[model samples]
Target: MSTKLKSVPNDFDSIEVQPLSDIIGAEIRGVDLSKDLSPAALDAVHQVWLQHSVIVLRDQRLSDGDLVRFSKHFGVLDFGPNMAWQPEANRDHPEIFVISNVVENGNPIGFLGDTEVDWHTDLCHTDLPPKASTLYAMEIPTDGSGNTGYMNMYTLLDALPDDLRIRLDGLQLKHEDAHTLQGELRYGLNEGDLKTIEDAPGPVHPLIRTHPETGRKCLYLGRQWNGEHRATFVDGMSRAESDALLDEIWTVARKEDCAWYHEWQAGDFVMWDNRCVMHRRGPFPSEMRRIMHRTQIRDTAKPF
Candidate 1:
């Protein structure tokens, strides 16, 4: 029996997907962010996203609703953590969170001061972590000091030695409540017993989780230190042993080769798989204005 190849649709020619790096990060050209995407365009985006994990679209503008609407196409929209919000962001659009260093009339507009934000997945402290996050730049420093960096956990796990991979086969991470992305503490939280997984301030998930859609495993590591509680140890491992192991893993996982950093422009929008990538930001001058709006997508499938 002979099978004929499926023909590519004519509309698919309108979109372009280009890899930004060898492992992660791709740029999608020829798509407008301000307008609604056609069904064919959406499917093209979804497929490219699954293959690249991180996709960037440039030179387009989107409002709070537009960003939220675009995010909903991929998964359940997560309005983000319930906490205090900037008056501007809270007035009508609580679903969209601001990430700016701009202050107006003695009030700071957003979170993350002009300092380096350590790498961590969005909402890892919660029982259900968001599957992905979308960040749209409104204004960014001309100097490009606040470039965002992403680490591909799929390759990070694959590059691990066979022994380390085997050893981490079934370990679960005890994630603790760090401050919110806006860098605020969760209400009624305390820094207590991080040594025990059950006692940690937040949820515990498998260190190596299989992606529900792709079935590919990625290393699910969060930040080391942040707020009252941090991920202190692996489940069923002593503090000393866990610390030693994490140090070794981070040594390789945090390497420069494992990451791709994106410098922001006013109209750049990036969507990344939070479940399979850990991201951080570089420090910028405090005097400069930098603004970004982010929407996170909630998880439906449990990490195995």
Candidate 2:
């Protein structure tokens, strides 16, 4: 456990923090985010968030502005690139991205339509990825689908084999920028423009990164998948070699013991640290509906 979490100041009077699981996530009770909060209250929430890696607040209604306001307290807001479909979906609050399976006027109203989103850190292909992401559930399928899972990277690194842990130190990974978590080519990128994984455009970041604030190291595998285009590869290593090592790393990461899944409630709001966590979602029934409002917090510095 983080020392900060263990020594949380007892000055908080407005909220109570309860651990959701031994691994990650804390449920915060007794605060309506729509209304302004005291500095101490926000500080308490922030501290718990850093220690927990993921935090949940339930049963509160918030507008786009309210969500953005609360998010700005943590860091500068990042408005993700517009999706190929429904480019105008967030015109009112560009910072608030929509995630949904709903279709309207023959066009999808949001991104990542009702499928199982693979594990990944948001925008890791960029030079500077977001520090964190916030999601608010507006509508969820009643059939018990679309639960989101989070993995604690700190624990994952500790769980690695001793030899593998030492071997991965000081290495870097090239994050491929052309593909989305859904496996679709991003907008304005031509598939024919790149022939090899080496030809892909994206930034390279340390395979093991130290959290800027906490200074704790964590494995930073941006993303991986089987296909023609290598989603990510290690620096100074052959594709085959990188693939072999990644296979081993991912095997440990996928262990059911290192993860926690959140079942959605209509008014649930979740915020997770993108630096030390990887998240994925389960597929929901196509006939059902799931709508979410999301915001990303920009990292002040590039990953070192």
Candidate 3:
């Protein structure tokens, strides 16, 4: 008998995969998340997600059931503790985290303020920040506004000068939930809401985080509103200096080529890796209506 085993057939040759943009995102056509996915198909999806930090699937036509089924294909899902928009969904599905501006009574709550949302990763203050997040647009504003922007941190790191990259190696930074709370309260968080936020413990992480899957180092300086905690430095710099340095970092990171903007459409599902990317929501008219459902994937690894 021959020592070599018989050749096995590959089933993924039929799937259609295409990149959305050269630098960041991809669109995987012809895969139905509603149906049972073969191991090969799941592997293909995983591969693309790793390659392109963000993936957009147009016309997914996913219902709540479809969304839940699709999310399970990735890893364990995380329903955030803080309430945002849909409380009923939270109660029914522990896997899906809701992000919306609508109240329980079907009234539209406009943006918390007219100001812009700064650059930040989701759930960074938690012990296990979300690995990925998926947002489905149910309704988009009529005006050509409310664009969601994303930055490819991996590309940003690649563009950095060698000296800066070397300096950021093994640096840590203090991440607090206080700023998020302040934003909420500034927008009118009630006493009960404030209590819930206070109970959640804050976490610290490396200023330059290493992607567990890709093994790439990324700038992890998120949006800061309150300046209370100590700095976690990788280059042995003081807090004030670190803050100034971060401003310089943002100047490079927020360049047009390093980022992509997505104009929302109904039934579009947008997913991005929180570990290696930062996102921001654009300003939209307060009078117009916009609603979106978000589900965040749980991070299996502990916070660095």
Off by over 4 Å in 3: 1-13, 81-90, 103-115, 181-201, 224-236
lDDT of predicted model 3 = 0.67
Which lDDT values do the candidates have, in the order given? Answer: 0.78, 0.86, 0.67
Q: Model 2 clash pairs? A: none
Ranking by TM-score: 2, 1, 3
Query: What ranges in model 1 sit over 4 Å off?
Result: 1-12, 80-90, 178-186, 190-198, 226-230
Q: What overall lDDT, based on C-alpha atoms, would model 1 receive against the true structure?
A: 0.78
Best-first order by lDDT = 2, 1, 3
Predicted structure 2: lDDT? 0.86
**194-246 per-residue lDDT for model 2 (tens digits):** 77566788999999999998899998988754322358888899878988988
Kindly state the number of residue pairs that clash in model 3. 2
Residue-level lDDT of model 1, residues 1-304, one tens digit each, is 1122122254445676778888798898877767777777888787778878899999977988789888889887755433354333445666677788898887777767688887788777788888989999999998869999999999999888899889998898877664455445556655462335456467778999998877899998877544223354687888778878888788787675679998888999999988899898988999999989888888896667
Q: Which scores better on TM-score, 1 or 3?
A: 1
State the lDDT at 103 in candidate 3: 52
The residue-level lDDT of candidate 2 at 40 comes to 74
